[model samples]
Target: MTFFDEMKTTFKDIPRPEGEISTLEFLEASESLVKLFDLFGSSAFSVVQNDMKGNINKVSTKFLSDPINCNTLQKLILLEIKENGKKVATQGLLWLCRGLQFTANAMRKCIDNKDWELSKCFEKSYSETLTKYHSMLIRPVFKLAMKACPYRKDLFVKLGDDLNKVNEQLEDWVAGLEEIVDVIMKFFESGNYGKGL
Candidate 1:
């Protein structure tokens, strides 16, 4: 089976009604997406994986603390704002969305440009999505990871035997991820939750 098929929670399954993303499912799907780094078969990707994991844990902890009030991601951040104004989970969710956007953009590039290498796709996506947020010191590390991407054909082969099927699944998965990131970003923009983040 493909990695997407094996995921416990695919982005396509996550609920986002009225632009409110469900917290538990999004966290679960984020966790599953982090595993995609493993498929790259390069230690350099550990940096990306760890960063995503840390943010996911932050949000998940808050959700577990009060699932009733934090049913939707919007509610989670709103309640956090109301209770403490600390915005720990809010910041974490923001970073997590950025990471997800980076991944989705990279995958979309790969799917859209048949001639492009994995390294090129990842580097281009990183430049557009996460470069500004990363510190100067952190940028080189991520750059190295992008350069360490496995050969496009090799990675695609590992994804599944049928390239067409893999591309189709990846396109749908990336589309779902992009939609989630867009919704969360718009919410953040509306509330200025990302003001100091």
Candidate 2:
């Protein structure tokens, strides 16, 4: 089976009808995505993995506190805002979405440009998705992780023996993730939930 197939919660399985993503499912999928960093086989990616994991845990903790009200991502943030007037989980979700976007964009670049190495794809995606949000010190750290990415072919081969099948699954997975990211970004922007975040 391909890596996507093996994932307990691929983006495809996350329910996002009308752009309202299920809270627990989305967190589960984000947790699964963090595992992808392991394929790089470098300590540098631990920074990326841990960042994503921390945000996922923040959101998960909030959701677990009140699953009935926080069933959907939007509701979770809105409820948090109403009760605490704080944006802890909201900010976490914003950064988590950005991280997912970075990963999706990098994978999309890999699918679009066969000549680019994984490092190049990651760097390009990082610039496009996360660069503006990162401070100078943080930017260099993420850059180091991007530069430490595994070779393209080596990573894909580890996914599955069939390159074509792996690419197809990856494309679908990235597409699903991109759609959800776009939805959350727009939601945050429209509601001004990301203000000062």
Candidate 3:
């Protein structure tokens, strides 16, 4: 299927949550997000570790050594895109992963802030960016990933299991991030962020 078709297929499964959020909801969301972030970090590390035969470490090193303001994760996405000339699915997924990592880091910082109101504002921006990236990039790439690696009863089942775990972890992270964003929006709407602590 074409990228557009794949994106449509992907979106069909995602529920579009609507309506306003409250401060209690936002706090709960943030807590869940923090837990997801921790889980995502571990999952990401596992992927890197499993790449013993691959060049993820080299790519990571190059990214860290680069003078750009962007982090190593961002550089990894760029490297993947550049290297995966014909692997559109891999390229797309890498970019989406980069966006996830970026959002996770941003949320971590926001959650650390002493000023709840400012943190909520920052979270709002991060959530908006994440939503755009997920819809425009992640869905199609994910389709590509599944297509590239068709399920088979082969000896390399372990590899497939690892990939599945990574994918599952990513989905969980996205869900947690969305929850936090919903709460942040509610906090702003209720003017709770502006109130004295």
On residues 24-112, what C-alpha lDDT tens digit does candidate 2 reach at each position? 88988898899988878999999999999999988998999999999999999899889976778998999999999999999999999
Give every collision pair in model 2: none
Tens-digit lDDT track of model 1 for 1-197: 78788888888889876768999999989999998899899999999999999999989999999999999999998999889768889999999999999999999999899999999999999999999999999999999999999999889888888777888899889998988899899999998988887
By TM-score, the better pick of 2 and 3 is 2
Report lDDT (CA) for all predictions. 0.92, 0.91, 0.35
What candidate 3 gets wrong by more than 4 Å, as runs, is 1-36, 39-85, 88-97, 104-113, 117-125, 136-197
Choose 1 or 3, whichever is better by TM-score.
Answer: 1
Please estimate how well model 1 matches the true structure, expressed as its whole-model Cα lDDT: 0.92
Give the distance in Å from residue 15's predicted Cα in candidate 2 to where it truly belongs.
Answer: 1.5
Better of 2 and 3 by lDDT: 2
* Tens digit per residue, CA lDDT, model 3, 109-165: 434543444235334544555445455654454333223322222212322356455
What order do candidates take by TM-score, descending? 1, 2, 3
Please provide TM-scores, in order, for all candidate models, with all chains considered together.
0.97, 0.97, 0.23
Please report the TM-score between candidate 3 and the true structure: 0.23
Candidate closest to the true structure, highest lDDT:
1
